[model samples]
Each structure stands twice: as structure tokens, then as C-alpha cells.
Target: MNLFQDIRALVIGALEIMQADGVIPVGLDFANVTVEPPRDPAHGDMATNAAMVLAKPAKMKPRDIAEALAGHLAADYRVDTAEVAGPGFLNLRLSPALWQGLVKSVLSSGEGFGRSTLGAGQRVNVEFVSANPTGPLHVGHTRGAVFGDALASLLDHAGYDVTREYYINDGGAQVDVLARSVYLRYLEAHGQEVAFEDGTYPGEYLIEVGEALRRKVGDAYVGKPEDVWLEPIRDFATDAMMGLIRADLKSLGVEMDVFFSEKSLYGTGLIEQALDALDAKGLLYEGVLEPPKGKMPDDWEPREQTLFKSTEHGDDVDRPVKKSDGGWTYFAPDIAYHYDKVSRGFDALIDVFGADHGGYVKRMKAAVSALSDGRVPLDVKLCQLVKLWKNGEPFKMSKRAGNFVTLRDVVELVGADVTRFVMLTRKNDAPLDFDFDKVLEQSRDNPVFYVQYAHARVCSVQRKAQEAGIVVDDAMLAAADLTKLDHEAEIAVAKKIAEWPRLVEIAARTHEPHRVAFYLFELASDLHGLWNKGHDDPSLRFLQEDDVDTSQAKIALARAVAVVISAGLGILGVTPADEMR
Candidate 1:
């Protein structure tokens, strides 16, 4: 149960009672009313803006409405006191029993305690880490991959039907570059010396691809011309690159439900079908007769080209779908792809792109808008760059990836859990500094270990309790006399546990998985604070001296914290450590 939601329901109920008693008008929009944890815990456990939002609409002063609402809320047993605070805001203090009971709910629900149905089973297609199939995934793609996977899991926890997708960039010129690169490697495999030109990939990762090609073809095309071997090598190289990419993604615990290929849209007429759907809606035309503003290209000239009327939706300019030479621009294929997504009957589309693609957001949204007739919504999230630091110095390029740090390199250094957690420690659109040393540190300053340490400590306590002949199983703990859990510090930890359900909804609604990481940090802090308090006060210890009943009650609270931590870490694709070693 969400205590914040419960309190909001109480506030709404109180307002309804006030209306029934004729203390206020009968009709006022309560949609804006919300109960959230006060910014400062010093204020109260929860705060509501019901009075402030309804004052102007009800033709009553905020204080006047707050006083009436507070008086009515104070009658509920769950709310200890509802005090009207500054500008008609109501601060609520819940009864200790309510927070104590939350611990029981958490233990009874186990890993499913914080799961929410806020999404209501809506179909959401999340396309992410669609890196070009030119090479193995690098560190930048690692960040996007982790973020997208966690987001899909977060939405799934919130009850959305999520489909994780990866769009292979095999239809671009980059794959041809890969083909030429591999062909050179193939020459070397046949005892021919070759120099990699500026356009060809020279990474050591492709050496194995070359060796494998030599094994499969037995040097049959070693001396063939470009026209004879280019097409076959291009297909072979792309498949090899995809294999490497899949391995890199698997190393970081990411799995995609769909691997859509840009090449497939070429032969299947899907691109034409998508554009025809938009053209039928009068959103497509053959006209792009204006030069870009401010800085025109040296080759700039007004040419009639196929354009989409994206300006009518929400774009800076009408975007070109076909170039003057009758070839589809990059934006055209992208528009057709999204148009196909809309026609596939998805309720929503979310694209996780790098920050460099920020300029494409508005036009892409406009295309989806015009194609779906404003019925389907698209959310584009831009992930910023990840800067790696080691030994307090910026890390240079990797030897394996040749130019940049490969995803495998990062995962190898810190393992998958630390790599995943550190990637999500910052907001998606903000720059992230990933320090190798800090993430591996064992202290409380390292949030990943700190959260895992809390879970491990609980496991240690359970072992100790079992050795002492105490019953700490779920059934026993759920039936424990929880009234013994009355210490101030113990109740405080339970209060943090009560925030899980509410935190899930907030993180899922905002499409921000980092919030789960932040909440896990705070929850760990609460647990550690309470654990430290036990060193000073023996009564607060989770394991009592020969008092089985009281010990089970306290142990139940500790297990409840572990439940939430495990669930949150599961969403992040981090395995919760049962022991630090």
C-alpha cells in the first residue's frame, strides 16, 4: 500500500466531507490535489496542496479551506495530526502503527510489494541502443543499453506492456565501410599485406571475423575485384558485427525483444507503405523550396523535393523526405519507421537516443503526430556522454575498441553490477563522470556497495538469528508481534520502507529510472542509520537476548528493508549481494 496515496485519499475524503457538511462548495476540480513527502522531513511525513489548488476555484481563501480540511482529517485514526502550514498547505503526521504495519505489508508481499498498476496494461514500445551495426558496442552504447533496459523493467513493474527493441543500422554507408575493412583483413588472412585507409575499420576485434571468413570461403575470393566480393562481404561483416554487439550487450545483462533491421524496410516495401499512409493524410508533398536560416551551405540552392508538412504539427521547418536526387534522406527512413510503429497499434513510442540526435526530436515527433493524426504520443529521451576516469585521471581510448572504450572494457573492469549502477547514478540528459575507483570502493560513499552491503548485512543477521535458534522465516516474521517494533529509530526505517510503492509510481510516471537508484540510496541510509543506533541502544538491536518474540519483530523490519532493496536492484539489473565477499 502507498502511504502517500493513502494520505492523499484521506485528504480528498476530508475535502468531500467538508463539502457534504456545507463548509465549502460541492464542486471543485480535485485533479491537481497531491500528497507528497514534505521537502524537509522536519515539516511532517506528508504534505498536501489540496487547499492551495482549490482556493481560487472555490472562491475561498486557502487558509480558510485548509483549516476546514485539517479539522476533518484530524478525525481519522491513520493521521495523528493534520496541521495547516504556510499558504494553506497541510502537513500530516501518520500514526506510528501505520508505518509499523507497512513493514508487515512489505514482508508479506516480498519482492512484489512495490509493484504498481499505474500503467494499466498500456502497450509501450521502447526502442533503445540502436547503435549502428558497423562495429561492436562501445561505452556510449553501454550507457544507453543499461538505461533502456532498466526503464523497460521499471515500466514493466508499473504494469505497462513493454517491448524492448534495437534498430540495426545496416542500411547505411557505414556497413559498406565495414565490408571494405573486412575485405582488407581477409587479404591479410591470405598472406597479402594491406594498409587500412582512413575509411576502413582497423580494430583488432575484426581480425577474428577475417580469420573466420578465410575458414568459410577457403580464400576463394581473395583476389576478386570489389564489385564481385563487396556485396557478399558486406552482408557477412554486418552479421559478424551484430554477433559482437549481442555479446557486448549480454555482458551487461541486456536482451532485446526485437532487432529491427533498416535493410528489411528496403525490400519489404514497408517504407513506401508508411509514407503512403502519411501521404494519404495530405501530410506529404513534393516541395522544399527554402534555404536553411543563418548559415547556408556553399552548395545551397532551392530545389523541389518531397517534404513533410511537419510545421503544422510542431517543427522549426518542414523537413525533407526525399533529396533533390530522388534518394530518401536519413529522416525519410526514420519517419517511415516510426509511422510503421504507429500502424502496428502501439499505444506509445519511446526512443532513447544520444544527445547528438537532439536536433531530430522535434521533427520526428511532428512526423508521428501527423501520421497518427495526433492520437499516438512519442517521447524521446536523450542520454548524455559518459566520461571515464581511473586513478583520478581521465581514461584514454581502449586498445580493443581502437578509438573509444568498448562496452566490454567497462564491464570487465567493474563487473556488470557496478557498471549498470554507475551508469544510472545521473540523469539521462546530464553528463556523467564514471570513476572506476569510486564505484568499487567499499565505503558508504559508494551507493552500489552501500545498498548491497545493507542487503548482505541483513543476510548476515538472518544467519546469526538462525544459529541462535530463532525463527526468522517469512511466515514466522509475518506473524510476529510487531507491537514490539516501537523504537523511534526502528519506526524511522519502517517509514522509509513505506515509501517504496509511491516511489515506483513516481519513477515510472516520469520515465526516470535514476530515481530508483536515488531512492535505494536513501533507503540504505535509513537502514544504516538505524543499524548504527543499535550500537548505542541495546533495545534497538534486531537480535534480542533470548527474547524470541521481540527479536522476530525487529528482524522482520530488517527483512522488509531487504525486500525493497532487492526489488529495486532487480529493476536496475543488479544482483543483490547476499554477502560482501
Candidate 2:
């Protein structure tokens, strides 16, 4: 079904024949050999740099090897012609029937056509949106949530066992700030005027939490001192904030397989165990770090602290695990959490962090490397900020979230599907502009709408075909004579369909789910092109009156396009629209 992969196999087979016939040296490495679509369609259907890659190693002219390889490749039934291009690059034109067969394959396979086994059943843990348990998720966390969820789905589709995880930062001082903020709201509920100081959360959403606390305990904590109320309220407030966060994530169609609490690492011996694992490997030691290069803190006196030898595993410098006061640093628990993941037998670990956390990437990777003894690989993806715009102006701050745009605000403005798809329209590390006006616009420039429109158009065709008394079942269309689909526009659509399998493999390999959005745009464009061509040529239309056989063949192609669109959108966690409303 993968035409590119099939041809690469053929190329390798031909090269091996060249070796057996003594035309090329035996045991030449074919690992670098690749067969992919040429940059320009004029070059050929596919191109390979096998000759150029092997020239210096084999001590032979590239053209001599390319010419010899071309002769062997041209003899294959699938390869119509193989010609030497610039600098001994081999350009190949596949037989027209091969492309024709690809369309039929898509029809037969349905949505499963593009599924790949490239991951080989490896277990991968993807931790994302570990936003502090201080408030409901904001606009920035929304992008990371969508990106990480889509990445998990993409890897799952490509044969990886993916676990979506969320790390709760309840052990930090910020959650303490949340507790104090809720305490102010509690006081206000007791008919006492309260003011939010500089560090306390000032959002009105906590008013409900205050009202609920008043309903539960009346005036018990109203006249109590800080000691009597602080611990109990901290636990209650943390749980409430987690409830709100879970609801927000649910609204965006996200669910986590695990919710690891940083507090759990403190009470248990987990943090100590994780650091001990590193220490046994000679990675932990007492050390003094130099002051910051540009601007040192006011209290910048150097002090000996417990540190991890992160430099051995590629970090810029060793990082502190314990402060000079013998308290665990913020990074110590994170290292322990990753060690726990490594001990769980995952083959790989992935962290989707915000771009602001870019400085932590190297140290985190080093921790995982040392903890896992280089057996497990960790990939860190940084999600950039999202700037919101509305009515052609910057969208102001949210009252509910105090100083930021809440995730609920976004989901309310545009439904969950639009929110998810628009967030992934850019690479994870690139800034995203989520313009409320532009995203909901029905024009082709809006990627979510454009891709949805393609699926809706296919549904319209199916409805029209069925109303005209034509059999539109998948089995009937799949068995139709596909050779009747010979138009250039039809072939171009089929070519795009062929790219789906290859696209999934590439996106999954790179762990970049944004590429799926890009591929959907291209697929939608190809489908729209075919739809427009029908207006100019009646024969290109999916419904053909008085010609049931040809109509079924064309409908098969249209349905296959919808099938791929639905699958791609499914990975994005965006519901494909059957009709634009």
C-alpha cells in the first residue's frame, strides 16, 4: 500500500543484484539509500541518492554506479524508467498502473489504509500539561494539552503503547499561594471584607469554592488562626483546583492515564530513592555552583549543596538536587518522578513542557539518561505561547483566570473541535496566534474549516449518489472498476491519498503531531481541487447519470478521501464534520 516504501524495497533489491553480479562491491552499506518523492514533479515520481552516497565509499564514479543501478531498476515491472539526473541522482517514474493500484488499495483498506507499524510496539510515556495545581488551565496550557494528546494518539496509531500523564505540582509554594487565596475567599464568605495581596490569586472563580467551604463548615474556621486552618484548607483547596483542572481538560477532550503528585514524592521515600539511584552511579555529590553569568541574585553567596552530576550526561553543568539548607530542590522530585517512569519499563519517555521551561530540558534529559543508564531515550518538546486575538484586536485578560485567558474561555468562544485543531496548526515550538475571528471564518484559509469542508463535501456526494438510486456501499464502490478513474485530476487526488501512509510514518517518527495538521491541509487541498475540476468537466463529477459503474468508481475515490480525513482528524482529537453548520 505504501508505494514509496515498495519502490525503496525494489531499489534495494536491484542494488543487491548489482553486488551479486560484481557490478558494485559486496557489503556496501545501503542504510543511507532512500527513495522518496522528488521535490519537483518534473524530476520524476521518485528520486534516490544511492549512487552519490556510495561513490566515495566504493571508490567509483557516481554516474557509473547510477547508470548500472538504473539498468537493473528499469527491468522491474513497477519502475517504468530510471534516469540519471544531476550529480548521479537517480530519478524514477513508476508505472501508471502502480498509482492506479494505490487508489484501489485505499478504497479497500478504508480508514485503516494509512496505519503504520513503525513504532514496533514500543511503550512510550508522554507527560504533558503538568500545570501547577493553582488554578484552572490557561490558554498556554491548552496548546500543550492538545499537542501532547494528539502526539499520543499519533504514536498509538503508528503502533506505540502511549500513556498520557499529568504531573500535579501540589508540593510547590504556588499551591500554598492558592490555599491563601482560597482562605481570603473563605473570609469574605464569613461576611468579613478581604483583600487579595500581591501574591494571592485574585480570580472570582474561587468565590464558589469559598461558598462551598462556608456551606460545609459554617463558622468553624472563620475565627481560627493560620495554624488551625492552613493545613486543612491546603488539602481541600488543592483537591478543588485539581477538580477544576480535570473538568477543563475534559472539556477539551483530554484525559490523563496518570496524575502524579509532587507531594507524594515528599511523604514517601520516592525522591530519596530516585536520588540514591543517581548517587550509586557516581552522579550525585556535594558541590558549589558559580553565580549566574549575567545577573546574579542579591543573595548570591556560593554555598555547598547536594548536586547531580548532570554534566556527565550532556547537561551544560551539574544541577543542584538539594539546597544548602538540606531541603529538596524543585528538580529533585522531578528527577524521582522520571526515575519512577523509567522503572515502569517504558521504552521511551517524552515530556511536553512550555517554552518558558526550555532551560530545564537538558537537565531533565540528563536525569533520565543517568537514571535509565542510557537505556531509555527521552524527548522533550517545548510548546510556545498562544496569543489570542478577537475582532482584529488583542483579546484582553480573563476575569475568571485573574491575569490570563482561561482554557474555558477558549472552549466557550469556539467549540472543543475548533480549539484543538487551531492549536495544532503550528509547530509545538512556534508561537500560535489563535484569532477568534479568523478561526471561525468559513473561508478556505481557515485550516480547520477547510479540512472539515472536504469531509462534508464527500458526505454530500454520498447523499446525492444514494438519492439517485445508486448503490453507495463501501463494498460496491471498492469492487468498482477503478481504471475508469483516469483523469489527471483524479490521478492527482490518488497521489495525495498515497502520501497518507508515508506522512503518518514521518510524523510519528519525529513525534511531531503538527505535521498531521499540515498533511490534512494538503489532503484537503487535493480534494478541493478535484471537486472544483468537476464544475469544469462533467465527467469528473462523482455522480454520473445513466452510468452506474463509472459513478461507483468515482464515489469510491471520494469516500476514500473522507476516510483519510476522518482518521487524520481523529488523531487531532477534532471531530470531522459531516455537514458544515
Candidate 3:
């Protein structure tokens, strides 16, 4: 099914034969030897650098090794010809039978065709969209949500045991501000006008929470002191905000396997336990931090504080874990959170943070490294900002989200599918422009539309073939006389299908789901190219009126393209279109 992988094995086997024949030295490293598609299709179907890579190590001329390797490779049935190019590169022309066999592989595998076992069932925890439970999720959180969800799905497709988690920022001063904001709305709900000054959330969404609080507790806590109302209201307000966040994520088709509360780390002795784990490693210390790096803060002063030896693990400087008053800093709970992840026996941990949190990466990684004794690896992906556009104009801000574009705004404006797909058009570290006009367009320039249209075209072929009274189910396609598919354009499409499994592993390895979007775009372009070629050549068409076998064979290839497209889209959390609207 993986043609390149199979051919690389063949190349290695041929090299081993060369070693046996004294053409090359014994125990030459074949690890760097690679068989991949030629940079230019004019050369051949595949190219290998085995000759060039082994030349210096074996103390032989590259051409001599390439010529010897080519002879051995050409004797294989799958390799039609192996031509030496330049000094050492070996270009290979695989037989049409290999491409034809890939179509059968596609039909047999269906959506599972491109799934990979590269991860080997390694447990990975993906923490994403951990926005503070203070308000509705904004545009930045939307990008993180889509990126994290798609990443989790991609890792799952690559055979990783992925746990999607959300860390609730409910233990901070921010949630206290939210409680006061809700209390303001509660007073307003009681027919007393209240002014929302600075440091309080003034969004109208909290008005409902206030009204609901009134329904829950009739006329109680209306005139209570801050101490009497602060703690209980903080719990109630955070839960309300979390409910709103859940609804927003639900609108965009995102769900978390775990919603961990930061407050739980406080009272449960978890934070102390996590820091103690680091302390046992001799990573904790009492030290004096230098003044703020660039420009000193107005209140800058030196004070001895409890710090973590983050610099020993890779951070730029030691980080303070406790303030002068012995209160935990923001970094302490984060360390505890990652400690919980590491202790849960996950093979790896991934954090999807906003670009603004770029400074937090090394410290968090240092914490995980120290806590897990370097046994667990942590990867942090920073999701950049998303700028919205509509009709060649900047999209209006949301009053509902207090001047920021909400996740629901983007989903409701276009749709969840378009929203998710467009969000991943760029890498997580790159800024993305989500244009309402451009993304919803049915034109081919829109990648989502083009890929969806390709899937729909294959569906159209199935409908026409069914109405023509020719059986086009997967069983029949898999059993078709695929040797009839010998056209150049037809073979090209099959070759693209062969790269799907490889693409999945590459994307999963890089932790970049944007590669899947790019690959799907390329696959759709190939499928579209073949469909266009059919118009000029009647024999190239997928459906033939008289020949049932020939039509089934060509239609079989088209169906395989749809199958792979659906599989790739599934990894991206996109529902493939059966018929374009």
C-alpha cells in the first residue's frame, strides 16, 4: 500500500545483495537511503539517493554504486527501469501494475486506507483551548480549538492514544473579577441599575447568569458583604462561564475528554505534591531574581523568593514559584497541571497555547522535564492570531464577546465545516486571515470548496453509474479489471493515492495538521485533473455506455479518490461533501 516504503525496502535488499557480491562494503548504513518521488516527474516515478549517500562512506564512486544498484533494482518485477542521473541519483520507473494495485488497496481499506501505525499506540495528552472560564471564547481561542481538535484527531488517526483535555483557569484573580461582574448583573436584574467599572466583565451574556442566580436563590445575598458572597459567587460564575464556553465549542463541533479545574490543585495538595516532586529532584530553591529583563518595572525591587531551577532544564532563567508573601505564582499551578499529566503515564504531553504565551513554552517544558526526570517529552504548539475578513473589509467585532470576534460568530457566519477547514489553512504558528467571502465561494480557488467538490464529483459518478445499471460498489471496484486503467492521467491519480499513508505519518510526526489540508488540496487537484482530462478523451471517462468492465475500472479509481479525501478530511474534523450545495 505504501509504494515508496516498499521500494525503499527493495533498494535496501538490492544494496545488501551488492554487499554480498563484493560490489559494496559490508555493514553500510542504509538508514539515510531514501526512495521518494522525483523532484521533476519527467525523470521517473521515483528517485533514490542510496548511491549518493553511500559513496563517501563506502569509498566508491557514486555512479559505480548507482549503476550496480540500478541493475539489481531493474530485475525486480515492480521496477520497470532504473536510470542513473547526474553523478549518483537513481531514478526509477515503477510498473503500471503497482499504481493499479493501489486502487484496489484504497477500495479495500476505505476510510482506514491512510491510517498509520507510526505512533504505535503511544498515549498522548493534548491540552488545548484552555481559555479562562471568565467569558465566551474569542477568535484566538477558536483557532486554538480547531487546531487542537484536528491535531487530536490526526494523532488518533496515526495510532496514538490521544486524550483531549482542557485546563480551566478557575483559580486565579480573573474568576474573582467574573464573580463581581455577575454580581453587578445580579443587582441590575433586581431592578437596581449598577455601573460596571474597570476590572469587571460588562458583557450582556452574564445577565442571564444573574437572572438564573436569582431564580436559584430568591432574595438572598442581595446586600451581603464581599466575604459572604465572593467564594460562592466565584464557583457559580465560573460554572456559568464554562457552560457558555461549552456551548460555543459545541457549535464548532469540539469536545474535550477532560476539563481539569485549576482550583482543584489548590485544596487537594496537588500543587505541593507536584512541586515536591521537583524539589526531590533538587530543582526547587530560595533565590533572589534579577530585576525585570529589559526595562525595569516601576515597582522593581530584589526579594528572596521560592524559585524553580528552570535554567538547569533549559529555561532562560530561574522562575519564581512563590511570591514574597508565600503565595503561589501563576507558574506553580501550571507546573502542577503538567505533573498530573506526566504522572498519568502518558507517553507524551502536548500543549496548544496562544501565540501570546510563547514566553511560557520553555518554562513549562522545563517543568515537565524536571517532574518526569526527562522520561516524558512535551511539545507546545503556539496558535497565532486569526484576523477575520468579509467582502474585502475587516469583519465587525462581536458585542456578545465584548469587542472580540466570538467562535460562534465565525461558525454562524459561514459554517462549522468551513470555519474549521479555513482555520487550518495555515500552520499554527502562522497568522491566518479567515475571509467570509472567499471561503464560502464555490470557485476552485477556495481550497475547502475545491476539495469538497472533488468528493462530490466522485459521488456524481457513483449516482450516474448506478442509474446506468452498472454495479459500482466497493467489492465490484476492488474486483475490477484495473489493468484497463493504463492512461497516463489515470495513472497519475493512482500515484497520488499511494502517498496518503505516507502523508498521514509525516503530518502526525511533525504535529502539523495543516499538512493534511495541503495534501488533501493536492489530492483533490489530481482527481480534478483526471476528471478534466476525461472530457477531451472519451475513453478516459469513468462511465462507458457499452463496456461495463472498462467503466467499472475507471470509476473504481475515482471512488478511491473520494475514499481518501474523506479519510483526510476526517482527520481534520471536516465532514466530506457527498454533493456540493
Candidate 4:
């Protein structure tokens, strides 16, 4: 039902016929040939580079080949006219009947109309929002959570087997800091005074964790040394912080399929096994890394360490896996984690990290490349910072999260639907400004409102048609006389609908769910444009007064727009509005 794909197939068939008639060479590769929507709608419904791409390869002039191909395409009933533009680019204007029939197809298919099979069922692991398990998630994590969840859903829509994952950073010095902070709160519950040092967390959120620990142990560790209670308290505090993080993600409608722990790779042979696999490939060796460029650190030293040959796989330099003191560096666990993912037999891997982690991308990709022998591809997406504004000033920090605004704070003020949609209004790598007053404004400048209003308008039309005793359900509207929708404005909306499947494939291929948000806005503009035109000409209205047959035809087109909008919003994890208020 993809009109662009259907027309491309028609063009390819014509080229093959020309080759058979000896009009062109027989062995030209047609893979480079493409049929896409013209940049300007006035050019034609679709444009193809078949003539231009084949001209040099076929040893013939582009115009000569375009003239012969146009003749063959003109014979098809679906093609209205095939015209050659600059440099022998072929533009095809499809018949209005083709666009009219697309309305029926959209109604019959419902939301499933634009689903694609681009990934061919490949298993893809999407790891995102893997914030350290030390506190509640902040606004930075919110962007990553929304981006990752939407990406997983988009891959699922495009036929990829997607697994949403979170990696817990529990095996680190930060958890030790959390443990001592909880101990301070525990002492406070036992009628003792304690001061939080610079290294300990001082957030009010951990006060409950302290109270819960006092209730569980009955002050057993109140006067104990650090060695006696540090280990057990570290485990307890990590579990509590993870519980808080789970609740925060649930509030924003994000759920993970797996929660991996960095500690699991320790006390086990997993890290050794991963490094050994690389060593077996002749990629690991004992060497001293070159000093970093520019000013040297006060503690900088050149010492022999166990390093990986990351540069061979495309990194800027070989990276250290083990420090000079025989302890694993931070990069070791990351390499081991990706190795475990490769061992799980996933076809591909994606990591959604904060923008600060941009430097780690190449080395991590190299690790996966060497681990899987280039079989599994890894793509890392970094989400930039989000600036919050309210009442013409910067938003205040959250006391609950200590120094940052918690994810729950944003969701409480705007609700989950608005929070999710607004987070995706910008590209992941671009800084986003989330303005409370502007996002809530009911106008075209607000993308979430504009898209939702289109869906709500269609619902209003259906209710009016039902009250007039005319059936407007999907099954009935799909059977309407769609040829009655021959007006140019109405046809334009149908043209926008025709781009849905193609847009889905492109967005999924690029691993950019923001494209879906962009396409939804454009489609809404077309739907609203046609709605405004109906006021000037009563015959163009969706619900024609006292005409049942014509009303069904027009209503069918509007419902098709809603179907696409609901599907797009569903991919973004936002609930479509049936009424704006």
C-alpha cells in the first residue's frame, strides 16, 4: 500500500523492459535508482533518478533514456503523466484515483497501515537511562529515557526485536559514598548527631532510607566501625535508590526489559573471559600509553598497563584495560558488558548516553567490533542537556534530588503526556529549551497541541455525523465512494497520508524517532489546511448538511488522518486527545 514504493516498482519494470528491447545495456545495476516525493509538491507526486543514475553507466545520454522510459510508464493506468525535468530527472504525476483509493486503504488498515518490515526481525538491544544507582533520575536522564523508549518502540514498529535495558552503576566508589550518607541518617534516627562530609550525599530523600535501616537492624550498627557495616549498607542503599528510579521511570511511562548490574561482572570470571577473548585475537598486550596532549595532570605518570588494540578497530588510540596497579580501569567493565551483549546473540546494539559521554563512543564501538569480529554493529546516541524555564525565569532545583530537578518534578507540573511529547520536540544531540508557559499555550506553535487538535477535530466530525443518523465507523467509511473526494485540497491531505509508511522506514533506518514527531506535525498542518478551506466552500466540508453519501466520503478522509496521528503518538508514548479540553 506504499504509493511511493508501488510507483518505484513501476519505474524499475519499465527500465527492465527497455534493457530487453536493446534500448539500454542489459547489466546496469538498478539498486541506486530511487523514487521519492519531489521537494516541491508543484513538481509532481513523485520524482525518480532512474534516468540520471543510469545514463553514465549505460553509456547513453540521460534525456534519451528518460524519453524512452517515459513512454513505457505512460502506458500504466496509475501514472497520469511522466515528465522529464533538469538533467533528465523523471517526475511522475499519479492519477487522482490512486490518491483517493489510499483513503480506503488507511481506514481498512487502521493504525497498522504504516507499520514496516525494514529490520527483518533482527534482535536489537537498546540501553538507555542507565543513570548511576545513587539517587532519583534528573532532567538530563528524562531526555534519555524518552529518547530510548521511543526508539525501542520505533524499532518494534519497523519489525526489529527490541529489548529495552538499563545498566546499574553499583560497583563503584559512588555507592560507597551513598552507604556512609545512609549511615549518617541511621545515626540521626538513633538519637545521635552526625555531620555529612563533602563525599557523602546530603539529600533529604535518603532520610527515609536511614529511618528504614534503623527500623530493620534495630541500631545494631549505630556505634560500629566502617568495615563492620559498609558492605551490607552499600547493597541496601543501592536497592533503595533503584526502587526510587523505577518509580520515577514509571511515572514517565518508561519500562525496561532488563536491569544489568556492573557488580555481577565482578566476583566472577566474566571480565577475565571478555579480556581473554580479545587477547586470543592478539588485541591485548602489556604496554604504556602515550601521555595525553596539552597540560599534564599533577598525578600523571607513564606506567606499563594491560591495554587493548582499539586503534586497529578505529579508535584514536589503544585503550588501557587494566591500570599499572593491576586493578581494572573504568573502561574494562564497559567492554565486558558489551561482550556479554554480543554473547547473548543480539544482531545489533544501541547505547543512549548523556552528551558528556561523547568521548567514549569510538572506543566502545571499537570494543564491540573486536569482540564480535565486526558481526554486531553498535550505535551510540548522546542526548544533550535540557534547559527548563518557567514564568520568564530559570526553573528552580529540586530539594528531593539534592542539586538537580528530578524527573518526577517535571512530570508533576505538566503530566506524563506533555512531558514525553515536549522532550522529543528537538533532536537528541541538540539542546532543548522546555518552556512551561509556551508548551501549554493552545496554538499552532505548540507541536503537541497542533497534532492533538487534528485528532480531536476528526472525532468531533464523527460525533456530528453519528447524531445526524449517518454511520461513520471505520468499516462503513472505508466502503464510502472515495472518488467523490476529487477536490485539490482534499487530495493534498491524502498525499500526506501516502508518505506515512515511507517516513516510518526512514526514521527507523536513521535511528531518529524525532523524525516521526516532525512528520506528524507536517501531516497535521495538511489536515488543518483542508479543514480551513471547507469554511469558504460548504461543499468541501466533512459533514455536508443533509447529504449522507457525500458526508461519508469526506468524513472518511478526516478519519484516515486521525488513524495516522494516533499511530504516531502511540510510537512516542503519548495518548492522543479525543477533545482538546
lDDT of all predictions, in order shown? 0.91, 0.91, 0.93, 0.95
Q: Which candidate has the top score in lDDT? A: 4
Worst 10-residue lDDT window, candidate 4: 196-205
- Candidate 1 per-residue lDDT, tens place, 156-188, comes to 999999999999988889988999999988888
Expressed as tens digits, the lDDT of each residue in 1-581 for candidate 2 is: 78888988988898898889988999899999998889998888889999999898889999999999999999888888999998799999877777777767887787788898989999999999999988889999999999999999999999899999999998988978888899899999988999899799999889999888888888899878888988888898999999999999999999999999889888799999998899899988888998889987898899999999999999999999999998989899999999999999999999999999999999999999999989999999999999999998999999988999999999999999999999999999999999999999999999999999999999999999999999888888878888898887887788888888899999999989999999999999999998898899999989998999999989988888999999999999999998998
Native-to-model Cα distance after best TM-score fit, residue 290 in candidate 2, in Å? 1.2
lDDT score for candidate 3 against the true structure: 0.93
- From the highest lDDT down, the ranking of the candidates is 4, 3, 2, 1
lDDT of 3 by residue, 193-290 (tens): 89988779888789999998888876687989989888988899999999999999999999899999999999899999998988898888898998
Model 2 residue 85 distance off true place after TM-score fit, in angstroms = 0.7
Q: Judge candidate 4 against the unseen true structure and give its global Cα lDDT, from 0 to 1.
A: 0.95
Worst 10 contiguous positions by lDDT, candidate 1 = 284-293
Model 4, runs deviating above 4 Å: none
Decoy 4 TM-score against native: 0.99
lDDT: the better of candidates 2 and 3: 3
Please tell me which predicted candidate would have the highest TM-score against the true structure: 4
Clashing residue pair totals per candidate (backbone < 3 A): 0, 0, 0, 0
* Model 3 Cα shift for residue 121 (angstroms): 0.8
Q: Report per-prediction Cα RMSD to one decimal.
A: 1.2, 1.2, 1.1, 0.9
